[model samples]
Target: MSEVPGPSKRFSTDNSSFSGAKKPRKTVLDSCTSDENDCSSEEAVYSQCNDGRMDGPFGEIPDHLLINTIETPSVSLLRSSAITPTVSEQSFILPSHIGVAGYSSISALPSFDDNNRQVAQNIDDQPSHEGATATWASTGSMKTLDFTKAQELLVPVPSDPLEAFLLFLNNDILDLIVRETNLNAERVLQQPGVTDKYRITNWKELTREECMTFLGLLLHTGTIRLNRLNDYWKTHWLFNIPSFRQYMSRNRFMLILRCLHFSSDPRDEDRLTEIRPIVDNFNTVMNNIYSPGKQLTLDESMVLWRGRLLFRQYIKNKRHKYGVKFYVLAEPEGIVLKFQIYGGAHEETSGQGHTQKIVLKLLEDNLDSGHSVYMDNFYNSYDLAVKLLDRQTYCTGTLRKNREGNPVDLSTVTLKKGEYKSVFLNNVHIGKWRDKRYVLYISTEHDNEMMEVTNKRGQVLLKPSAIVHYDNFMSGVDLQDQMLSYYPCERKTMRWYKKLFIHVLQMSVANAYYLYNKFSTKQRLNLYDFRLSILEKLLPKKTDQLKVLKVEHKLTKIENVKLREKKERRGIRTIKEIVRKECKGCKQIKKRVATLYECKGCDGSPGFCTQCFCNFHS
Candidate 1:
């Protein structure tokens, strides 16, 4: 019910290549149609030449009938005529098969007259051992269509989804989090049992590379139980990486993770709202990159989340029935173009209904004349179809008979199996077909025509073209859901925002990888290979020197509080307990520096040389 906007300027077509070619002038074509020997004229129309016998018009035995309407400069006379015959004596004959039953074969069809015989030679010259075929036989090799050029002209190449993903988490966001966390450093360090000086307050702004490494670790390392952090630190290869340890510590990671701020204030309602920035940043990047084709599908998907939430949905049929609901618009290839997070009871709707509004919003920026949108019965209605038609967009969707504004006569029609009826009301084509169950469909594009479809059992059934196209294209969002589930990135999270974040991240990765395959000039990487590439980029292999270290040495160092304090730096006149306990400094000769100091200000006053203590403390 919203005012539909014009087609997106970002998705505007580049028709310069097509429009640049001037329309073929009629005069040029008229020049070729002369009256000499009609067979000698370029525009001579003829029927089948029966084994080199002229049966059709003008008594001219010219070659093939099919003509190249475009691209070819000259009209090709399939076969040349030795002599011109009178118009009254001319007769036309349809091509006939000599041997085969139902099949048409052009093989061994005779060539044209002597002057231009080779021009009309059949595509396949080998004699058919079966029935002699005709009518639909290939005349000659048709010029191949170059699909690469066509695709380039028609479809805009999608931007890398990975780049978009990283763009959303750019350096500005990292610096913002660091700046905010540093403001609350005192409170973080004052927490109970906070003994490590290098813990919470040592926050630093993360580089893009470091942030990438952090996300890589989060994605690569399955999940760690918070209670068993030390266990993972000791055994997990990812946690033991020297570079990772040097850049961040476990406690620091958690502290900063919790302290991340997208806005200036946590208590400000507008500032702390979590989903806003994420959704905006993601949608901005997604919309600017890929443009949807004329055919689009609208459907619902679930981001599986079992945690407590007000907007979580539980559909009886969905695989993950209980999760965050998303209304998605996608192309036939399952590339997501736009999406809306369902707010459940809080959603605003117009008189057209929630489903209708969802569709309109998804297509608000894509209301071009040639665009066709397909949906299931849930979002289909006579009024909705008319609305889309008014915007110069086409709509095709299955309908419910009992829905408001449906044609009463079509819905009431009694038809046996494999039967269908179609009727038009105000430019809306309504069709009712009986398959396993009777189905009603409304379309602005298709007529009531039926097409023969062969099932797996080889049974031919007539189905409406509307139904066939709906079945083919109405699964875009569902296909996207399936692809995302194949290598699911969802993990257990207590925060609903975190659950949503990970879901969006997974979507971004899948979309990026899908587009990469579609547009890449090099050998395309499959989903598995694409993911592997991301893993390698995020967490590169360790250096050989680090790889050779003992597992125990690689693990997080256990802090000996007593020995640590003993090595504390002394003031100018500070007193020290010079302990002879293994010298604590030298192994070769028991050389103990008198500079070992103990201070009451620190816990567990263990002795330490001034130099060792200074290096250890800070």
Candidate 2:
């Protein structure tokens, strides 16, 4: 400079605005301003501007021109035209300057008006960056979220008491009971005397209401119909459900029918015809109501009924007077399966004959045959046993003392009463009437083989061919022991009552078997104990009177009894005819007229009095 400046400050006539700048200008020699270098500088500035890199001190150009340059020119051109902007340079540029600079004579920047708003609307219509990124991330990710765990967190936990109660019920137990009972929701809902208090609308919640409903259904299906459920409830050691009391009120007839049916004969056509449809319907209903895979035992029972009804003309076998018979086929667990009423003439047939007919009919009908038929000595006949064998059924019962032939000798044998021994027979005839011929056979061997057989009246009969044992006479200290077990007792007191007692005792044995199977355990029970247990629970308290009222009304009209008179013949009288007199009129020939005149119109008397007709008309 003319007045030499310090080294840090420099100026030139063309660069006077560069005074006080941080950098000092060089002399002509030091600057070395060649044409090639000048060309290079111009090219750098043009490239930078065209590349849209103008910023900070170099970014003073108007926004319109700047925008136009950016729109039209390539980034390389901008970078080559001028120096590339640094981070600091780019940061300082005003947003307004983005399109105003006319470096490329660019169009004006968009204003915040309708056209710009529409453009913005178009931009808004495009998919968002965040949304696109999310979609990409979801598709590209390797690990996935576990939904079950998530659902557990999202769903609300049950807070209601009823809902909590239901969670406690064992699903398996419920399913088991439902399948066994075979009950439908509607049937359960409509059970007699089922109060709304115990009605369950929601099964998921095991509330008191649900318990009541379950109990109601159970009672409806089980012994409730048989009149034994009350006994079971009262006697069973476990649960004491009070709700069953309400069911007893309306189902007495049904209960009675169940009991009668259970203990009656299955072969009596009259009873079978009357109840078959009902039993079939019950089975169908039970199937529909219950789940499959539940099983029940099939067994037989018998009851005896005798009265005026047995002698009615409409009743079959009305001719008989002494004995009445009822046949009952039941489930192994004592559920009634079928029943028949037999009396009068049918009783005259051998008990074996009756039993065989019934069993055969049931087999032919495909009713049920899962268990051995149990019977007393009367039903145990060789012919019947053979028939059962033919039908593929087992028979477990006592044998009649007087069978059909000469008894086997067992004098030296010390076998127990009701115990078996083998004996060979060369000629053993079988079957009813004369249909059977001689056959070889092996029969039971017992000490009473040659003893005289008798009926209840003690009438001795011809010795039977086989010496079969009566189950009643078998002795045991533990009466509940198995039938085959050894025991000791005097056989002298064999009577009908003893036999009957034996039958009752067998019921206890059967029940014990049932209980053992049911609970998968070994526990014995006797009839007396069983009956006592049942009575204790079943007997109503003195204070609890039966709700039904009994009324007896007599007919108002009195009827006279009429008796028929017997006809009698009198001996002829010959002496009374000696006093006959004759009457003559107008000298006509006349015969003597008797004091009595007989009229032709009437059988033996005249219309007038006998004296007047005889004396005046004659």
Deviating ranges (above 4 Å) for candidate 1: 1-207, 221-249, 260-272, 346-352, 544-618
- Tens-digit lDDT track for model 2 on 67-137? 22222332222121111112332322435554422221111122334333311223212222211111111
Give the number of the best model, judged by lDDT. Answer: 1
Show where candidate 2 strays beyond 4 Å: 1-273, 278-307, 311-325, 328-340, 343-352, 362-374, 391-397, 405-422, 425-618
- Candidate no. 1 TM-score: 0.58
The stretch of ten residues in a row with the least summed lDDT in candidate 2 is 132-141
lDDT, model 1, position 608: 52
Provide the TM-score for each candidate, comma-separated.
0.58, 0.24
lDDT for each residue of candidate 1 in 1-618, tens digit (9 for 90 to 100): 112122332123556523433322221112222333233322332211112233322232122322223322222222211111222211122235422211222222333344533344332223221211111111122111111111121234435435434544556555654455455555566778877575565656544565566666555443322333334344233344444454456665566555544434454424215655556566666666666567889888887788777768888788888988888888887877788787655445434267778888888877753678999888887667767776778889888765545544564579989887776644667778888889889788887778888888999878889888888898888888877776654456436665676667677777777667777665777776677677765667767645434322111122332322233555344343324322223322367554334432323344455554454343
